[model samples]
Target: MNFWNRALIIILSLCFLLPVFAADKPNILILGEDAAGDSVPRSSRVFKRVLDALINQMHDKGFDVYDEAVLTLLENNSSHIRRTDSEIIEVARASKRPPIDVVVIFQIYASTQNLEFNTRINTLLMGRLLNVKTGKHLGNFEIDSGKNFTGPAQCQQECILTIVGDKSRILANDLGAVLAEKLVWMNNGDVSEPSKNNKMVTEYALIFDGFNAKEYMAIEEYLVIFSGYTRHRPIEIRHTRSEIWYQSSIGTAKLDRNLNKMLAELDMQSIINFEGNTFTVKRITFRNKEIKENNEVW
Candidate 1:
């Protein structure tokens, strides 16, 4: 399904189910930048309350999560508050490990509008989750707290924090948890939090593996799931079989044929397995005893 359609389904699904525990460690890249000035003092730290509450809640539900404040760590008055979006993104990536499953980018908007007698001011919070490597936009959400939170009227950082809390709980209770779980599933499947580093196991199997925090990130880019085969076979239970059709370049042919040619010497059996949005070898299969020349996942 398209991202939006999937997001709609997820949101609807969550609206359908009660909140529950998430099964894995989660690395969250929180992007919070100054939205207005005289920008709220310590607003970055206050902004973190939203992330922390969500993380802590998910942690209670069983998830490993982390976050940071980019502009707050530096001087407040300096132009760091006005950093480019890419600069903010770089800072967000700094808080994460190499293979980030989810990147939660946030924005804080402080503004004023004309109202009866006095003006109405507010702080708006907006955020979205993106897949790090693919740069694909997964989902976005926003909320505006009606209270005027201008310089003097504001209760310092507390008012903003309260707004963040409201938004986060709403999102987490709905879109957040489901998407997070699906993302976590993609990050690592039935792989257990090892009592021992599975390095020996992965190396022997030739799948690259590493631990990020308490969880392991493993890659068997070559091991296409044959669907029917077991690494071992049984007399009656055994049926069907498959192989990891290898290719020189991991890049798929979806982008271009030149990519197909330049990545590796012409080989017939290797085919595009992990093309576009797919994760495992299950997406490809043999047909008429002849599926195509070659290809599979990244």
Candidate 2:
């Protein structure tokens, strides 16, 4: 096709794709917490690097991701102020920076200090998502990235020797990727709307049908950044029946609303299990479907 013909085809394609593109972008926030003085001893710069990777990736993908992990931790220290959904919204909007459309808040409990020989850190990071205005905990999940996953041979990385920077970029890359995916899922994964009949106005049970940290991470940076939507609350990896309740709330952008609808369109299905050359995306039906997708051995 000639240049003019190509231009005509491009315009037609955009007309078909614009509605999905024009949907609002949720401004996501990242919040990390520890019990006051008990924070990881040398973490001032650690998180910021991770923050950059996540935000940069998400930005490239299409969402407006904000780094608010620092401020939220400071707020957690204050006693009198009860963080309401509205306050969350204000916090998001108050940002001379963009508002945190969806939040990735984590209260980490790490057991790396207890190690002796081949020091392995077992961390239980409970990641919670909140709507900025309402203090509604959209979803919460446990992100368990055990340092032991690294083989002894892999531990030979000379660059991984820093006591403070013990966790390698590879680990960070994996964790960041997974977290990014979950962030995406939280921001965009299909959510079964909480019953409006409830006396409480906050919605509960933000779910990803089948959960895989990596699966969710791969798409997170891409969708939220490129798709123009905020992340919903991210749920942890677990097996349970009852809805995961919201511990706090935050207001959402117009993009978040559309994300919920997109997830709903996914039929609320997600990847649940990983087997050799096979993967499963589950829905509420509990019926398992195996899909054959291509993968290359790099």
* Tens digit of per-residue lDDT, candidate 2, span 124-169: 4445566664556666655555544332323442322343233433
Q: After superposing candidate 1, which stretches have Cα over 4 Å from the reference?
A: 1-26, 35-45, 57-61, 69-80, 92-98, 112-119, 146-298
Tens digit per residue, CA lDDT, model 1, 200-219: 11100111111111111111
**lDDT, each prediction:** 0.40, 0.42
- Residue 98 displacement in candidate 1 (angstroms): 6.1
lDDT value, candidate 2, whole model: 0.42
Candidate 1 overall lDDT versus native:
0.40
> In model 2, how large is the Cα lDDT of residue 93?
53
TM-score of each: 0.39, 0.38
